[model samples]
Target: MTARALQRMIHVGCRELGLDADTRRDLQLVATGKASMAEMSEAELAKLLEALKARGFKPGFKPGVEPGAKGRRPAAPRPDLRYIHVLWGLLGKAGALKKPGRDGLNAFLRTRFEGKWGSVPIDIDALRDAGQINDVTRALKDMCRRAGVDT
Candidate 1:
């Protein structure tokens, strides 16, 4: 995971634990090897998480798990048509795609999923019927990350 993601997890854990500033600082020092949580290596971040968990600070969600979707089971590992639509909307809002229609989406997909583009239709209905939704979802997420917008 990225350092920023690790830091976010740590902050969320601290908040849930109701840790005071001083205690938080000490934990940060122990976990990150610095007073601040900035620029921590992956190993250090793992250490920090372990320390916090040992201190009874259970994070609301595990690392790599997206937040929200309360009271529902975690989403399936495979991407479905509905998930593709959700990702499409998110990418559009993030300004990663130029326009909002099939043409614009297809253009974006062409750049990322070159090999699969010829088979995948631009029309959402056609794409769904083709059963290439998983590939599209994966490409959309990759594009979002490359565009520096969290998926």
Candidate 2:
């Protein structure tokens, strides 16, 4: 697969639709045929995301067993626990977020991130990964709720 294609899709489309990891993985499995795509109904697929989003997740297609998910790739270390704390730091300070315009989130990222995260997708994914910071979805949602940010 092309990184250009992936990057373009991530920025131009996937980000806007908000597909979440499992949903993205399911779709990719269907696209790549690793998993049977026939059995699941649209409702079933949407439920996985809907359930999470209902609890405040900023759902998006994650496309594979993410850093945190069932049936994940082995020995990925389950991501960093403190990353959640960093996100909580951002959300805790969300009230102090700059202007609520088109770039509000981007501005937040600029102020919050440094070095490598000064780029797109990198910073965006860091924020997105916050939803999956905890092993359990409820924990993720609780974090989102704490910052008044939709998970």
Candidate 3:
């Protein structure tokens, strides 16, 4: 793979593992070609994933795992997404933003999202940097369905 492609892959992998802020920032630098992914050792990557697993952030296939003709189909309709319906709907209303607006989303998130997670959000740029906006959209739809939202 091209170095750029590999860097992108590494970026996605790091995010999937719920990396801490500093590590995620460093990886993002590498991903954007400002730094080098080769600087990190394979051992470091393995250890990071181990820690993620311990935190209940196990990485698996896309949420929907379909069977062949004889078995049950995958439950998810849009398995490629990230985040969830609330974010999806909120962000959708603010489409085509190059970066999330400073005030708009924050206000909604603070109010509507407060008690749901019992905390504020972390860097939203993490999701934007994934470069899979459509997949994230699809994933949110599937999430809504799975959550029994009458989708």
Best candidate, TM-score: 1
**Model 3: which ten-residue window has the lowest total lDDT?**
73-82
- Rank order by TM-score, top first? 1, 3, 2
TM-score of 3: 0.25
Better of 1 and 3 by lDDT: 1
Per-residue lDDT of candidate 3, residues 18-135 (tens digit): 5766776554454343334455455444444444445444354432343333343233233332233345544445453233444444454456445754655453233342334454
The sequence of per-residue lDDT tens digits that candidate 2 reaches over residues 1-151 is: 2444433443334344566657656654644443432444444444433444454444343545464566632332334534444444455566633454224534544554444344443333344455333332444346467667754
Residue lDDT tens for model 1, 37-123: 665677788788888899877676654455664544344344565576677777788777778655676666666565755554554
Angstrom error of the Cα, residue 67, model 3: value is 12
Q: Report RMSD (Å) for each prediction in the order shown.
A: 13.4, 17.8, 19.1
Positional deviation of residue 13's Cα in model 1 after best superposition, in angstroms: 0.5
- Number of backbone clashes in candidate 2: 10
- Whole-model lDDT for model 2 versus the true structure? 0.45
Q: What is the Cα root-mean-square deviation between model 1 and the actual structure? A: 13.4
lDDT of each: 0.69, 0.45, 0.46
Model 3 spans > 4 angstroms off: 1-10, 17-37, 63-151
Ten residues in sequence with the least summed lDDT for candidate 2: 72-81
Where in model 2 is the C-alpha error above 4 Å?
Answer: 1-96, 116-118, 121-143, 148-151
Candidate with maximal lDDT: 1
